[model samples]
Target: MFWFLLIAMVVVIAAVTLAVVGGGESDVLPEAAPQHLTDPLPLTRPVARADIEELRLPVAARGYRMGDVDDVLGRLGAELAERDARIAHLEAALAGAQATAADRPGAPGMFDEPPADRPGDLPDGSGERGEDR
Candidate 1:
């Protein structure tokens, strides 16, 4: 009778464990599913500095794929740095040009400041000079 009772208890415990633990299937979404969190972002517009800085990725069962995320962030940082440097260089060039024009003798009032609407003719170097007469 004691053996019978012990066997019945073991069966009850096994049944309860199986019922509580669900099944062998993982609760996490599969990596390959279309609706999965790994979908690529559509970069239709340029990513702003704040957008990149505030970016977050979904966490998987083992957390995010750190190496991949780090690589992308590194690339974004480099690109942002390059853009900032280029903007600074261009601004300095414009300031230098304005200063040079201001210092020239008989310069027009426009020399010390940039016009609100810059004319496109300046880039082609097509200004009418007396030599062309």
Candidate 2:
């Protein structure tokens, strides 16, 4: 029984070795991502918000010129945040306007123009005092 087990183990090892050796050249091996792939900035590519946020610059003898990179990243982050806030504000305004229009009794439809006759008209084309101009 011991001899049989030893023979089986040897056969398994031989099979594994043969399979690995028979596999085609290094080309068949899984290729690793290039070193630069992890860096946020790649030459000739446009930088994005996430790329700026997650950037990892290489350091040399004097180390990285971090002040410049930090300033740029901070400015970019702030700008991106401000733009997001503006988008949210606009979206909220749009939603509120839509809701107000929907609640009106006679809201104007697409291509419908407000009455130019009214001095100060509401969105529903009602005059300021709900009377005809």
Cα RMSD to native, each candidate?
13.5, 13.5
Q: How high is the lDDT of residue 39 in model 1? A: 38
lDDT of 2 by residue, 1-133 (tens): 9999999999999999988788678648676643322454534644576766687765544766575567657766776787899999999988888777777778674344666765444676544654434
Candidate 2 has a TM-score of 0.36
Model 1 / residue 37 / CA error / Å: 8.0
Give the Cα RMSD of candidate 2: 13.5
lDDT scores in order: 0.68, 0.67
Residue 44 of model 2: what lDDT?
Answer: 60
User: Model 2 lDDT vs. the true structure?
Assistant: 0.67
Error of 2 at 95 (Å): 0.6
**TM-score, predicted candidate 1 vs. hidden true structure:** 0.47
**Segments in model 1 whose C-alpha atoms lie over 4 Å from true places:** 1-14, 20-58, 109-133
